[model samples]
Target chain A: MNKTINPLSRQIFIMAFSLLMVYPVLWWLGASLKSNAEMSSPNIFSKNPVWSNYIDGWFAVPNYSFTHFYLNTFTLIGGVLFTTIISCSLAAFAFARLDFPLRKFWFAILLVTLMLPGQVLTVPQYVLYNWFGWINTYLPFYVPHALGSGAGGSFFIFMLVQFMRGIPKELDDSARMDGCSWFRIYWYIMMPLTKPALVTVGIFCFLWNWDDFFGQLLYINSVDKYTINLALKLFIDTQSAMPWGQMLAMSLLSVVPAVIIFFFAQKHFVEGISAGALKG
Target chain B: MNSDITSSSTTIALSRKPKRWESPLAGYLFLMPWIVGILVLVAYPMVMSFYYSLTNYTILDTPEWVGFQNYSEILFEDDTFRQSLKVTLLFVLFAVPFKLLFALVVAMLLNKEIRGLSFYRTMIYFPSLIGGSIAISILWKNIFGKEGFINQLIGIFGFEGKSWINSPDTALATLILLVVWQFGSSMVIFLAGLKQIPLDLYEAASVDGADWFVKFRKITLPMLSPIILFNLVMQTITAFQMFTQAFIITKGGPINSTYVYVMYLYELGFARFQMGYASALAWILLLIIAIATALVFLSSRQWVFYENEGGK
Candidate 1:
């Protein structure tokens, strides 16, 4: 039933919604370029844009540079992506392919962990980290990702397992017929075929680690060791006047890498999130 | 090549049942990293937290056995605890339904064949990716602050606006707005679910002379119920655990009006160094979420429709 609605009205509706969605981002970009004096002015949009705020905010924090924060965040993301890919892929392969004793029980245990809020374990985890001398180090930041420890990582593993289940058992049977060991079958056959799922998992791990604020705040105390998100918090805290321009400039800069990653990995992001939801 | 293949198969046959730990060892090896990580990081800490919840532990000293004192105090004596609970509940109540509704509406709109669909989807989904960061919280504070962009826009309508981030009445509302703005992720999931719904169902309804509203109610709503449940559970959990926005924008400010439960727990554990009490609060939160989720699952039997069940 092609009920002809007015194209003009629908376009207007789309435009209005788009503008409403885009307005905050535009305002943020504008505010990030405005000086403190201009920020205090009645008209936020009318202010002369000072492009140097980005440079100034870059150097504003003492001893701990934005570059350092960027590096730290990148390392965290890299570490997480690397470890999550390895561990989740391996575990997913085992769960999807191997017949083992009490496999369902173990899978059920993993599922139970997903429901338990991370906050419930924060204090004890902090103490454990402190006890292990992992506090103030990047170990606490990246170790969980490496180990498939969080809900995101475990959920990703579960997702990969489901996708792997869809792969034909004939491939495994053929590989076995060709005298390939189980390990070789998983490594050579399954791993390469599951690249899309891996990419999805990798993008998620990277984005999650990059944007993680609470974990960084809890684990990393020193400014020099701070992730980008933690540095952004520090930037907000130390500004005498609301350094709106510099804050915006830094925030915009901070979001650029994630946005770039998101754009490049958009397909995986969509597929992974949807698959995860559907499976759940 | 045949001799090589024969030798490999013979080798596999030779190694198949050599020992109890031979074949499954590789499987266990593959899963070792995650298993060990869970034991050290997840399981151990969880047990420790449960133990700590029954004690009077501070960061500076060893935990002393207190046996339900912390839980009792939080339930009865602490006013801020009560306030935080009320604020968090209010925030969840206000945010979750609106978020789901907004997600469903946007998903419906985007489900149509449109020009620049990818671009529109990107624009919407980008916020959810960005909103999880501290930068978004900073942006939120600036936008909602007195003499900020929101006020500037309000002035265009000849209305003077108060400092939203600093006012008790408006602080929580601003946080709610922030939550609402990040509806993109859920909307994408909903869109995916919408795609799975066969268009022929809608066509059949239209052939029966069903109105748009009637078709939407009878067809779309029932088909979308499972996705709705998924979104609801996830969004509810997120809403309850909201921290970054409140932390950056108001710091649970203006007479603890926006003081969310998690923020209070953070303050108790980190700021005040009350580890035991904080652990207790965490467990309480876990209980609350689990009960709420269980309740939803129980109610889903009544309302949530699975397509394979033939709408039973």
Candidate 2:
């Protein structure tokens, strides 16, 4: 029920909290553009903006090229998105439609993996990767995505399965009656109908792989092989004594791609994350 | 004429008696990639980790089976392990409730019909998207450092502020604040849940002259129980596995006061090359989380409401 309180006061409260949330980000952007001297000054907001820090930060380190880092991150995110979509969709189809023996058991096992912490697996995974000579290579970063190894892949499979279950079984039966193979029904009908789930999975996989830090740190050893997160870490290490302006500049720059992608895929991201919870 | 007759008869037979394994075989083929991947990447590693937990293996050396010695040592002889457990439990205990409450309140506010609702929602969710990033962690370190922005702000209020990141007393607390600030993801989920709730329930309560607080307690909280449980379980898991912030911001320093279990496991596995011991720690963490989750599920019958159950 609507309260007896003044609508004006409610509006004011909302506006104030909104500003509280937005101000830090705006301040971060402002600080990032200011000169080093200005950043250390008493007045944080009054500083004169200097955009050169972004340029200089980009070119600061040798062999730590921001371009290479971007390419590596792009490859990682792309591989994750592609592999997650293909593998999870196929598996989700199996769980959602094609009834086979012991299906419930296998699905339960898959759900169990979702609860296991990444740290519990990290040690053994490191040893295994080293044994396979996969360390210091992109294989460590991308292979899991391709293989549906991490939580993202499992969550995607679960999400897609939930959405797929909502599709009418009569469509599959009709296709079967028309002499269409199971594969044909899945590829032609089910896949197209589940585009929303695919988009949701794709956006999440992109954001997750792009922001992954621990995985990158463990796998990529050389400076030249650094992803954006690793590069940012190295930047911090070398410029520990530098002004906050340059560091904040680089940090803000590092987050721009994620923010941009989030805005572009905002609808799908929210739907994907909340759908399972809502259904449950 | 004879060949055409034979082909027609074969087609009739094929339609009459389909291959028993055909459909399932196709399904298996479709599932092959994920199945193989899970076997090699997930299942194999899990089994191997169980094996490693029983051994005294370093990364460079072959493992020697030692039965339950590693588990016993960790359980009985390790002080650092106990301390890590304490720190982690403290974190989950303090952070989860406050995060859930803050998220719920903000979500309720946003659920109201307001101008620019999407913008407000977007603004709130920004922190969670950037929450675990190294850049944000670094920003936190700077903001909480001595002579940093937070202290400078405190100075205006005539309050002396300590070096939050460096001080053992405040390091973990600062991280908790950081986590609470990033309640955006849970907030979004809560908002979605709030939208699903029928307005008629509140209307009915108001018809009976129920007050706001009474309606909220009787209706809103109960209806939202499932979503609350979802948030609680997920947040609890994430909190236990917390690594990035403690690693980058505090470095688990100032006498290991901020040394979270996962961070210590990382040091053992990668930095110190103590794979066997790290695997033991990992298993312990898994056990802790599993037990905690089990406890939640066990208690859920008391608080969590399922609408379908009333029909049954």
Q: What is the lDDT of residue A98 in candidate 2?
A: 85
**Candidate 1 deviant stretches above 4 angstroms:** A1-7, A40-47, B1-23
Which residue pairs in candidate 1 have backbone atoms (N, alpha carbon, C) closer than 3 angstroms, thus clashing?
A: none
> In model 2, which residue pairs have backbone atoms overlapping below 3 Å?
none
Report model 1's chain A TM-score. 0.93
Q: How many steric clashes between backbone atoms does each model show?
A: 0, 0
Per-residue C-alpha lDDT of model 1 across residues B1-312, encoded as one tens digit per residue? 999999999989888954453247766777778888889888899899999999999876899999999999999999998999999999999999998899898888878878878888888876889887888888888888887888878788999988989988888998998988889999999999999999999889888888778877898899999999998998888788988788888899999999999999999999898999999999999989888888888999988998887877
Residue B103 of candidate 1: its Cα lDDT? 89
Residue A23 deviation, candidate 1, in Å?
0.6
lDDT of residue B161 for candidate 2: 79
